[model samples]
Target: MSLPRQLLLGAAALSLAGFAQADIAIEMHAVDKSGVGKTIGKVVASQSRYGVVFTPMLKGLSPGLHGFHVHTNPSCEPAEKEGKVVPALGAGGHYDPESAGRHGFPWGDGHLGDLPALFVNDGGTADSPVLAPRLKLPDLEGRALMIHAGGDNYSDNPKPLGGGGSRVACGVVKSAPK
Candidate 1:
């Protein structure tokens, strides 16, 4: 019944309400030059104290670290790049609305869509959650989530996009239905 206690409760309630409004679930799938394949699982994206947390429930991926990112478009279909078909190329490049034009850490001054690498266990499942401190729920809309075929070094040296190689999996982040 104390005033301080009431203020604390009020703040907690407000935080929860804000988070509830910003949550989204993106369905992930295997992708290749053929296009999006069977459903792998889903990623539950939510707001946390530090930033947005992406908890994936994916499976059937190769073991080791894989590059993860938010691409500029919201489609997972394959597209023609040069003379070759690139899977998930319809998703465009990494979300760099500011024109950073380079790859960096999740909290660095580069692509706003840069995210921490995802780790796949030996059993071929990616259940570990990763954080993108520079991202929020609103930044995800009208974009696509991409998983690369290789690990990310978080640098542009000697390779582009952290040498993540090909796009192995993808998911589109659609707006919440009314």
Candidate 2:
């Protein structure tokens, strides 16, 4: 084969190999409640350069904004029988990849789990986008993504993420199909 032709072929092969090596698969699941917790909806997420993009499958949700965050632990335990949460702020706190030392989205120094507000429709269904830095496709392999009751202001005024209330729903992330 000619030298020029061989070089071109090698370059093409290398390009294809690089494209094939890109990480693009992400998995999502609907976390089922164990006890007092309310099973609200499901979430489907995928990884992107910005972060982990999320698409929530909401049902029976109340109209208006809801607080969403990436909890530290991967457990989706239900609220206690006394109507109190198992861990005061179980699900751990916000997912902090860089540990920027703050809460709320757009802060740039906020937790990776501090996502944008989730607005539900009149029909009680919410379909929105969220980004979590703590999740890098690899870290999300066994972690959990949770949705809270109230709306998030993305600030710590009345509270971070609008002091979004209780843990309404939860989901565990998995590796996407090959």
Candidate 3:
């Protein structure tokens, strides 16, 4: 085989391999008061050295600010207060990749998982372009994302998003099948 032809074939194989590895899907679910689980959205999370890029399919949501976070626990089971499963808070706290000092959105001092607010449209849908740092596919095995009733200020003061009042919805993240 010619040297140029061999090089071309090698590049083609590498491109295909990269494409196959780049695609990753994570299962997401929303838990409600009846202890019933609903499919709220699916986050196609891609891993990079920087963090995880999540592209969510948003629909059937109320228009307004929604608090989105990575909780510590992975349990979708109903919380004691209500039958609903609070995955965000339920998971525990924010995803602190660096364990750095506390800070707000657009800032990197706080938890690596701390993301910007999720804005919904009147049509009851939201599309998020957010990143969760220090997050690998393995870390999300049992973790889930919770949507709050109110918006997240990303601060602890006035008691808006920081308060974490209600668990509007939640979705458990599972590895996509191969």
Point out the higher-scoring one by TM-score: 1 or 3.
Answer: 1
- Name the best candidate (by TM-score): 1
In candidate 3, how many Å is residue 96 off?
4.6
How accurate locally is residue 61 in candidate 1, as Cα lDDT from 0 to 100?
95
lDDT of 3 by residue, 1-178 (tens): 9532443343334333443234455455655555536677665655545455555577777898777776656655555535534433445656555665453552346665555566677888775445554456566665666667777777766773365566666666665333
lDDT of 3 at 145: 68
lDDT against true structure, model 3: 0.58
Candidate 1 off by > 4 Å: 1-22, 176-178
Which stretches in model 2 have alpha-carbon errors above 4 Å? 1-40, 79-90, 131-135, 175-178
- The candidate with the higher lDDT, 1 or 3, is 1
Candidate with the larger lDDT of 1 and 2:
1
Q: TM-scores for all candidates?
A: 0.86, 0.66, 0.67
